[model samples]
Target: MTAPLIGDAVRAPYDLLAWLIGLWSDALAAVGDAFGIGMLDYVFMHHAFLVGGLIAVMAPLVGTFLVHRQMALIGDALAHTAFAGVAVGLFVNSLLGTGISPYVTAVVVAMLAALAIELISEITDAYNDVSMAIVLSTGFALGAVLISLNTGGLAVGINQYLFGNLATVSRENAALLVVLFLVVSIVVTVTYKQLLYVTFDETAARVAGLNVPWYNRLMTTLTAMVVVGAMQIMGVILVAAMLVVPVAAAAQVARGFREALLASVVLAEIAVIVGITLSYRYEATAGGTIVLVAVAVYVGMVLAGKLQSRRDVVEESGAVTGGMDATAGGSAED
Candidate 1:
């Protein structure tokens, strides 16, 4: 009886999962039928859209702090390192039949690479960019060599990692993205105030008795996690764009730090949805399409900012002229 009870307990979660999946599928189908759109017709398309939406929120969430700290290029650096990790996973699987997923290796390697970047900066007193450059070069070099050695094996699906394909997202990978999104969201929420302090003024945070180094490490680790998760849809080359572009566009119109963070997430979601729709309609690369949409949003924001500034200046000038005329007329009457 105890054995049977234990088995039932283990199976309960699986039963719930199946029920949730069924409910979600039914909802998706009903929406599709009503709207006459085929976006969720296939399982892979559903996974792609789910993961893309998660990336939209996670990327810009981390990106807001990265932009403030001027560490925008760390995304690109970690992405290259993740590419190398993927290469290693592929090579090892091909050589030893380990049956490991490249994405697993990517997360591990990217986390290690993130630590290495911080260590190198601390030990050598190098600039963040310098550390990033060293890691980026070495990582890409190793990936290229590994791919060359296992050309017949790794070359087959390598393009999907280099340039994302919405159709290639599997259910397992989408589940991983969901886990990553939850983890990132929770960590950021818990550490929001501390991170804000460190971001704006690390020295002041340290003076206020904060563990500056720990927060720095935490930030980089989170960035690596975000990179690995986003790499599924954004690819190695363009994943960094999601991190930087949305934050930049948000900065143009945001009046404060918190506003920028929220605006960036909103902008990223817009870019992701539009980009995914366009990619599906035209059969284009999802990563490139998303980045291009982000760039267009940035340009629009810039134009709006400039126009707003000009209007403010004109209004201020008219106010000053009106006050001067009123003062002069009052003096003349006196």
Candidate 2:
């Protein structure tokens, strides 16, 4: 009886977690049904929306640091590398009858690619972009070659991976996105100060006795994880847009680094929700739609920032003119 009770206690949290997930899933289904949207009627659409929302938050959260460090293109490089990983997984599965998920392979490959980029930069005294270019070209070339072989006949839906499709998001992938989001959020929260210090000034951080190399690796690793998570929906070509656009838009008007980070998340969330809705209505590509929305938001922010600056300048000019007129009037009266 004691052993049974202990087992039950150990299982209680897991049971509760399952119950909550079920509840949320049902709730989302109900909302979809109520909306009477054709696309939302399918469970895959729900998964896409959920995954999109999660990526919206995670991308910008990580992107804030990436943007500050001038490593924005690293996202693109990692994404292409993840594409190679996907190809490898598909090839292996087809050839050896392995049942591994492509995403698992993608994560592994992307992390390796990221480490390689860092290593090359560290060892050869090369610029970060140069290293990234080398990795990007090699990864994409491998992916293309593997895809061209196509001996496994697994290239049937390769377009979906390259361009993304709304129906391609499965429940399993959505769950994976949730896990990635939690991991990224926790890591960022825990390492916020150190990351901030390193982002602004790596030399200063090193001078202060911080482990700069470790944090650099950590940042790149986190970026790779994010790239793989996002690849399911954003596809190979446009996935990096999510990682950079929102942060750039937020930087246009943000008062500080933290503010930019928070604002970027908000902007990304808006873009995701709107883009998903629009894609559903039009039966369009989810990845392209989301990226288009993000780009629109970025342009809007840029325009708004310009207008605000102009207004500030005009206000200052008016104040100066008013002061000059007052001074001239006072002198004449005296």
Candidate 3:
């Protein structure tokens, strides 16, 4: 009887182990299959990566200066202003029923708005931040009113524009974003030195014949171009996170301007790539996830900075003690 009971107990455990193994195997296979499909769906899959990379690079390119100049809020305003353009585009497309590209129209209108804001600031001699605030509120209010009037067509697009939905990004939008990213990259590269000079010291750059106002306008235009491209990928709502957060994180770690720019780009790229991957798996909005990743990185960087500061203090104390000991030894020998 005892022998029979022990044999039955062993068989029961073996059966249970086999069942668990099969279940785990099936689960892993399902995940693998999904991953395989994602890999094969390159056309759709590549859209996020392409757009993400463009925004990642461009945001940091402009954002480093925006942070340095303490114009982070202006970046926020410009993003909202771009929303009005998107709304107007939706309205026009609905009324005319033509092949109107809302994003292209949005970019053009946003550029004009940026130009107008710059002109207003120059003429009124008002605070630029205040000027940006006025433009942001005005543009968003205009967009909100238009959206209310054309509730059906404009409303759907506006909601997505404000919060962003990367999974819904269309092919046309992706292609246009690619073109804009290339254009912005070339322009920034060509004017890099002038931008850096003006960003550091506008008065000195102006006296040295760097055309400060022109560079300022050029920078704004670049920001607009990036904003338009990013609007599709990250949407107007979270795109500014890419602009400011990565740079802020990078600033904590980097020493020189070039290093900061490179670090910011890397952080931005990491955020987008990882965020989108996780979002795709979890069925979340890619843009929001990307911004969240950026926030996490920023927080981690702050903590790292604090730790580094502590380490530096420890090292400095050790160096001072060693120097004093060496001086005492020399005096004793004398």
Candidate 4:
């Protein structure tokens, strides 16, 4: 319930993000008022959109690298661990009567899990699925145990996180998501080239003197952050879809890495916006609805990609046949 956020600089980021949310919410409220939109009248709707939109952008941004590097499962792994992180936060608060945010604790634990993945990869010289599976299993099991131990009333509250609830998007949580978005965006922007090189070609990056392990750690840690942020709306079970589905859709149509990344962000934003509107109108679960909408988008993208490929093939055949016919006619005239 109490997701306290970061250390020392906490108050400043929270205030800044909260102010930004307030600014956007006010504008949205104005638009709603002008149009008489029912959902926009609610503060929770504003926060839900704020958080969901940010998650939509950053999930694919980070996911592009992960998916290309075949690390899609890392998002899922970290999400499960983040669930455990939520449990840890709740357990500590109840057992010791502290008021720390479960989200803050989730961030801490997920980052540790990120580090553990990196270390295992570095030591074993392979980033395999087995390790991700184990980390995910351990984290979820630990969370289940902790929640059971403190089953007085903690279990009831875990459902929002397990499956996500849009109405639970508090202003504080919205602010926290803003902070995460900034951190992820800034870090990725600054280290874009290095991460790109490391992602596409680790050996060349190492030969060019890039610290591969550091970038790997950074990528996973970012994934952890994105997972937890999106978990507020997408829930742990489906949050990873935001990371993978849009990126996959983009990949189907995009020819280059950056193109795919940009396209993924666009596709994801569309999914989030449409998903939110539909969920609101139909009284459905936001997480599941958004994901279903995303999958539909993905299927559309796949069909388009197939058509594009077929068009290219037909064009090539026509070009070759025309070349052959022209050559035959020229020889006959000679």
Prediction RMSDs, each to the true structure: 6.5, 7.1, 16.5, 5.1
Per-candidate local distance difference test: 0.87, 0.85, 0.78, 0.90
Model 1, TM vs. native: 0.89
Please write out the lDDT profile of model 1 over residues 140-249, one tens digit for every residue: 99899999998886898688888877876765566567678889999999999999999999999999999988998999999999999999988999999999999999
Give me the overall lDDT of model 3: 0.78
Q: Write model 2 residue lDDT over 34-73, tens digit each, in one string.
A: 9875666667776777788889999999999998899999
Taking the tens digit of each residue's C-alpha lDDT, what string does model 3 give over 4-88? 2124645665455435434544554565477774532544555556667778998898888878877787667778888988888
What's the ranking of the predictions by lDDT, best on top?
4, 1, 2, 3
lDDT tens string, model 4, 65-117?
A: 99999999999999999999999999998989888888888999999998888
Query: Which sections of candidate 2 miss by over 4 Å?
Result: 1-21, 33-39, 313-334
Candidate 1 residue-wise lDDT at 36: 88
* Model 1 worst lDDT run, 10 consecutive residues: 1-10
Considering every candidate listed, which one attains the maximal lDDT? 4
Which residue runs does candidate 4 get wrong by more than 4 Å?
1-9, 316-334
* TM-score for each predicted model, relative to the true structure: 0.89, 0.87, 0.82, 0.91
Q: How accurate is candidate 2 locally (lDDT)?
A: 0.85
Error of 2 at 14 (Å): 8.8
Error of 4 at 155 (Å): 0.6
> Which residue ranges in model 3 land beyond 4 Å of their true spot?
1-42, 313-334
